[model samples]
Target: MRGAHSTADTAVQAPPHWLRTLALLLICAAYLQGGLVKLFDFGGAVAEMQHFGIAPAEPAAIAVIALELVAPAMIVLGVWRWLAALALAAFTLAATLMANRYWDAPPEARFMLMNAFYEHLGLCGAFLLIVWEDLRARRARRDRAMLAGTKGSALQ
Candidate 1:
């Protein structure tokens, strides 16, 4: 077994932290812009909520803007990322279903609406993957800690 590679040794390494951070920041840009825009154009944001048939449009607009802002920041900063990802995923799914009702669209508009629906679904999948990655990393860290403790106690 000398000099032989194990499965763990052959596993692919993750990209550098800076690269991962940059990618996450880039992914969050759209959400940051959206939240800022909504905040800046309060009336328009409210109208948009009304257009989506969200009751009490003002409060709904505020809630959505808050989510858009907070969730993306949490994700980018790697703080409670799994929770943020799950929140964004749920928001995206609800928005997609409400906004992209392709079945109700006029024949001429249905294709574009369907495309948008699928695109949002893809975003949902991406967020879910974020949640999965976060959970996996947490579990790995915990396992490593437990392993280290076991070895330390054994050596003592």
Candidate 2:
């Protein structure tokens, strides 16, 4: 009985390959697409930011554009994902604040603010998905190890 494998021991295997691939794809695509858009039409984005009460449009626009474009690539490659996520999350938070600050503007003028809030939520969701998948995979690996250890001990 000392080395008997418990039910919990068999349940903790790494997550299925497909799930991990799907999660990676979804996060990469969403983040990369947004980054590309910001990078390509940067001037328009700066002008829009000005409309939202952001001052000194040129520098802010340049910084945000760079962060959006580069961070997504870093995150997708799984190199410096945590840092990229942090930067992106911070950017999203700023956008949200900008949006709220202009909430009382004319309906047409508020579109950017609304879009910023939605995009921020989407990025946050993607980050959470990556974290959840990572956790599941780790849990599964632990379970598999536990089962293997139990079985080996029983045979000794």
Candidate 3:
């Protein structure tokens, strides 16, 4: 029985693709909700932008909403996922720095603001990991194709 398969071995196979899709959905839900809320409450979003001291508040709100919607969708669909991840990562970083300026907050608010800042930093790191994985997969596929091509030509 040295070479025989075990139940644990069978159970150790890779997870189904749907699990990945589900994970992507969960990861994107926040952005999707934010985008939809902003779309429905455009005036409120603009006001928030003005509160943040973003010039051209209306236009900035529109752009932020658009990016929040489109980028997450792209990532979920695996369509230009790297670019989407990069965009979202950059957006998260900027928003964190601007909105979660913990040092400027009063002592009572500083703790919460600091937590939000760190959470956004964690999100940015996740996005970068996604980009890295995507690039690694693409390189692996390209390398496999090249190897196969070389093998085929050699056999000819």
- Each model's lDDT comes to 0.92, 0.70, 0.91
lDDT of 3 by residue, 61-110 (tens): 99999999999999888998889999999999999999999999999999
Q: Clashing pairs in model 1?
A: none
Model 2, TM vs. native? 0.58
Best by TM-score: 1
Error of 3 at 70 (Å): 0.7
| Model 2 misplaced stretches (Cα beyond 4 Å) | 1-8, 16-21, 100-119, 125-156
Better of 2 and 3 by lDDT: 3
Predicted candidate 2 versus true structure: per-residue lDDT over 34-60, tens digit per residue: 557767888787887798768798787
Clash totals for all candidate models: 0, 2, 0
lDDT of 1 by residue, 1-156 (tens): 889999999999999999988887776677789899999999999999988788899999999899999999999898999999999999889988999999999999999999999988988888899999999999999999999999999999
Q: Which candidate is the best by lDDT?
A: 1
Clashes of 3: 0
Per-candidate RMSD vs. true structure? 2.0, 6.5, 3.4
Q: CA lDDT of 89 in candidate 1?
A: 90
TM-score of every candidate: 0.92, 0.58, 0.88
- Give me the runs in candidate 1 sitting further than 4 Å from their true place: 1-4
